[model samples]
Target: MRALAYFKKGDVHFTDSLPEPKLTSPKGLLISPSFTGMCGSDLHEITDGPIFMPKDGETNILSNESLPLAMGHEMSGYVKAVGPEVTKFKVGDRVVVEATISCVDKHRWPNAKNANTPMCDACKDGCENCCDYAGFSGLGVVSGGFSETMETIEHHVVKLPDFVPMDIAALIEPLSVAWHGARVAKFTEGKTALVLGSGPIGLAMTLVLKARGAKKIVVSEPASIRRELADKFHVETFDPSKHGERAIAELRSIPEGGNGFDFAFDCSGVAPTFNTGIAAIHYRGVYCNVAIWGKGINFNPMDMTLQEKNLTGSIGYTVEDFKQVVDAFEKKKIDPKECEHLITGRIKIEDGWEKGFLELINHKDTNIKILLTPNNHNELD
Candidate 1:
């Protein structure tokens, strides 16, 4: 099987001899990927990583897999084969993989160290996204979609609607990330939102807000290119750099009543964006951190104490989040045409390293989501 894999630190490339993935459980399904999106996390793995990936000679605690694993989590594909006990899907069905691997998945990896261990509190409570050993299939748990085929249990697969194109289906994973953030904030219809940074996740937040009926959505992004991309969604775009010290003040004035936003999501994961997201919201409003910060920042408890504002942060999404996002698309809450704006480029798996990964790293600002295909399904004519 040909795959784009992580060989070691700063060493990811395409290889033709990587072992093919197999269904590891009776309820598992083998899938041939149609399209998979390149993520910022993937770039991080190539540049400053092995963060989530196991070390060169080490094995992932959950899946017991080592480095040189195929890399791609945001994927949509067609079922190629199904284990005898898999009743939810059959061969040839179009599907999208949720991609999260956790303690609840012990049944799938019988040889894992924790296979017989009791379920973690989070998994027992149906929050596998927060499971004690939470890791993504592609990131570390096992070989992922950036290959000829990948396998996973039925629990992580979601069926795609007939109207959704395979390429658009790849966007569902990122949208689910934004959707989970909105869920964490307890966002509701008609609420105004302030989304800090219009990068991939930031722009994704804008789309989710619009689909959920946000009265107003203001995307505060410093980069002109990103702001331009956010504007395509018909949401208001704010250049925070222009306002400087008064950025939060200007952001609050955009929503109705001129008080503050009902919800603010920090997708940029920086000191300024974090402060602006918290400060720009009104009393009792919610501020959700959707970004993956690399370091800690100074914080004062009194900031939220006076306002009674709620603070929360979102991490990996649950399977339910994936279902709801697909429901949103099926019911027309999220327009597929609008979702197309997020896909900046597409390339074959053969060119995934150069045209897909390197393109995103070198020209970060110019692209949003770059998808790679194995060309097995003819999704890329």
Candidate 2:
């Protein structure tokens, strides 16, 4: 078996003659990947170096102790072999694996508010994703999608519709992220939405909002290239050319505006976007932060107090969120133009190292989601 393995520091490459993963569970299934998406977070971990690895004390939870860590998570594949305990799916069923991997017995949410660490009982008993110390696949926390063949627990697998193409099924993971975030925002019919950033996550949020029947959608993106892409998706694009309060003013006055929108989502992970996303929301409105930022920034307590808006932070999705995202595509709720345009490029695994990685990091202005098609011996690359 050939797997793209990440070893040592600042290194990941494809390697041949790796040992094949054994079927270890009664309900487990093995899949030969069709397509795998190279995520930004994967690049972050690669560039951030090794000290900050997501490990559980002595154990490296993200990347297994085994050398040559597997490198993908966003993917879809067909079931090659099913365990005896698996009844819902057969050997030839097309499926998309939910990438989140948690301890079978992990935490629970006790009314959404409380105080504690890993042993909060509810945290371990509820769902691994909600646990503060929950482990995830593809982030080096657990093994991922970049292998010719790999095993997945039946609990994390979702069956895909026959009508959806395999390439489209590869998008279910990120769409789940967007679907979870938009559902949290509470946007509905006749409500306005302002999305910051025209990157993959931002555009994903917009599509979900549009599918959910948002009345008007406005976007604030600094890059003109991304702004044009947003326009192609039929979202009302706005430039973040002006700074401070002026930027918000120019954006809000789009259709002779007053006050602003019912919901705003910050997908840029930039300092200004975070502040402005909240400022652009109406009184008692909802603001969802879907971006991942490692640094801190200031926020005015007075603004939050006076506005009385609900601020929510969304993490990864639940099993239910994954289902909703897949069903949206299956039902054609998400537009085809919106989906294809966002997939800026698709390269083979061999092209991923420098060409694909550098383009995404240094040349962020030109691309969105660059997918990597699996180059398995049986599959056509």
Best by TM-score: 1
lDDT of 1 by residue, 155-216 (tens): 99999999999999999999999999999889999899999998899988899999999999
Ten-residue stretch with the least lDDT total in model 1: 372-381
True-structure RMSD for candidate 1:
1.1
Error of 2 at 358 (Å): 2.6
* Per-residue lDDT of candidate 2, residues 240-280 (tens digit): 88465588876656533677788888888878888888888
Which parts of model 1 have CA positions greater than 4 angstroms off?
379-381
TM-score of 2: 0.88
Q: TM-score per candidate, in order?
A: 0.98, 0.88
Query: Clashing residue pairs in candidate 1, if any?
Result: none
